[model samples]
Target: MSTPTAGQLALADRIAHGGPAPVAAISHVAAAAYTDPARWAAEKTALFDRLPQVIAPSALLPRPNTAVPHDGFGKPLLITRDADGRAHVFMNVCRHRGTRLVEGMEAQYAPRLVCPYHAWSYALDGKLVGLPRADSFPGLDKTSYGLVELPSRETSGLIWFAFATDADFTAASAVGPDFDAFGLGGLHLFRRHTHDVAANWKLIMDAFLESYHVQRLHAGTIGPFFKDGVTAADKIGPHQRSAVGRVAELAALPPGDWPALRAAVTFAYQLFPATVIVVSPDYVNLMVLMPRGHDRVLVEDFMLIPEAPATEKARDHWQHSWDLLDTGVFGGEDFRAATLGQQGLESGAIEWLTLGTLESGVRHFHEEIESRLNTG
Candidate 1:
């Protein structure tokens, strides 16, 4: 399988959930998509430059609620559900004279966005409602002077927004597997932490696709359980699935444990670009890595339980699992080394980070990025 056929390659690409190539000896060349800054900028500007299709609309959340801060056009946005209960996302800035509209997260849940600078006020839906100096702009239409509204909202219990004008706007559909495959949709946000890792976002994503690092990078903790091979792979569409496990967890495991843990588990369904759901028997975790730029990456980690995990101890156990994962994920000196690699990229580092023969998960990810960037 030195050069896996295109169909086989595509299958493997989807199965390992777009991880780099696996160790079955099958091989293929994966195009590197992030090496060019111009392309990266184009992706950021074209895909994330307008309304985020996944970010829910203001009308989605429960009423008597204030718009939570979410990513919109690379800025922190606030959506307020007014007395009428209509949800609206407004720039945290004031429209009058270019002043910031809102200052902090949910501050006072103000009836309307009012500029503390000069006391100019706008309705929750971004309509200009009042101003101290009403006479200042005699002809300015309040309707035309509302706050800046970025296309966004909640969908399937997750915060998604669009900033890309050229996007397909079918983010939900683009996410390959339905909500069921990721075992999400009903999962609420149970935990969150952001990491400002110093690496290209693509690097961060690439790092997650393969298990090669587990052997050395996570040896002490989780490395021993999950081996270096992928158990199975499947692609339902844009979403890819991989079943992975370890010898210790699987030895003598009953066939019934397959859903949660039968010595193996469905590693996750990767929604290309930046979303992954790793499911275990007791809980599920969502890992969202958003690129801030070439050197700044934000990894927002979330944990959720299917039905409260049957007991507090079980819940604690799941949290402990995440703790274990988070530790191993951030553990060791890999991050520092990664920074060095990034620096080397500027040093005219090797043109391409070799995909090696075994890291198929990474190759899949890399290939998809290329598809997104080059597809007509």
Candidate 2:
């Protein structure tokens, strides 16, 4: 379909109220950029390869009865608590010669992780404890041989880590004034889910950008609230927040609460890499899109509600909201398959693809990708 010109967006707002949304037309962007192998190669090296894949240490917040995934390569990483009730993230590796320090699911709040490789060990704080044959490496200074430590922090109900090695972490992460202003930490963990999808990482982000697909892809469910051509966009840091107001909430909104009504209206935050943070009046859904490769991506969806619903009635209330989202936005299998098939275009199969202006959100996404790749 041909994309609409920039001029059509204003009209799209009106069409979403009643008329059909015309196909989008995009300029100042190109389709090959999102699909090109050469460009993809450049992306991996230029920006992504240079950026650290680690998160802040504090992001490992587990629910009262839940355990965070602490998978690691060196010394099995351990995330547990001590008697003091403080949470900690530590390496499960031995201090002697890089042996794994701990194994298995639950290691008690032990002060030290003993290495079975040579009976060498490390304190829970990562200090070198002992070497069964301490004289074997006599000149070795045990203090300098502690397990590799990582920098970390916790915020907004999630743990954030700096995967990059001493790379001025403060500037690399996206936590700052804007996030504080939004008061993201106020929300609580509610629910979570995981989905393995067949598409480029960006395709997952694109799935939530424009409301245009709702009328067609989700005609029976979420369609009534969102329509083609009706949405707004704003970018902060590396995150983009797009929103479309819903009419369903208006019906029950208590008298004269304009501010609350506005707050209840939309889904926001399409953060970089692959994280979609949906903020609603009742709950918060944070979706992490982890790229497996150029064509395979996995989405980890975590819902943070005002509180976890232990009762069935409360659970249903939370499910009702996400049920619409699951079948509607999360159901992008067919769309992704189509994009993947386009990979054949590189083989002289097709000359070019198109983008509609109404779908400029997609264009904006590519522009951001291009900017990062080129500048990095």
TM-score of model number 2: 0.69
> Model 2's lDDT to the true fold?
0.55
TM-score of the candidate numbered 1?
A: 0.71
Residue 333, model 2: lDDT of 39
Q: Which digits, one per residue and each the tens of the lDDT, describe model 1 over residues 59-99?
A: 23445535555553267676667677655566677777786
Which lDDT tens digits does candidate 2 get at residues 58-159?
222432222232443222465544333345455555555666566664324455556777777666555677777777787999889876765554443444
lDDT per model vs. reference: 0.57, 0.55
Best by lDDT: 1
What residue runs in model 1 are displaced by over 4 Å at the alpha carbon?
1-36, 50-64, 70-73, 79-89, 105-112, 121-130, 133-140, 174-177, 180-183, 227-230, 236-239, 245-264, 305-322, 331-337
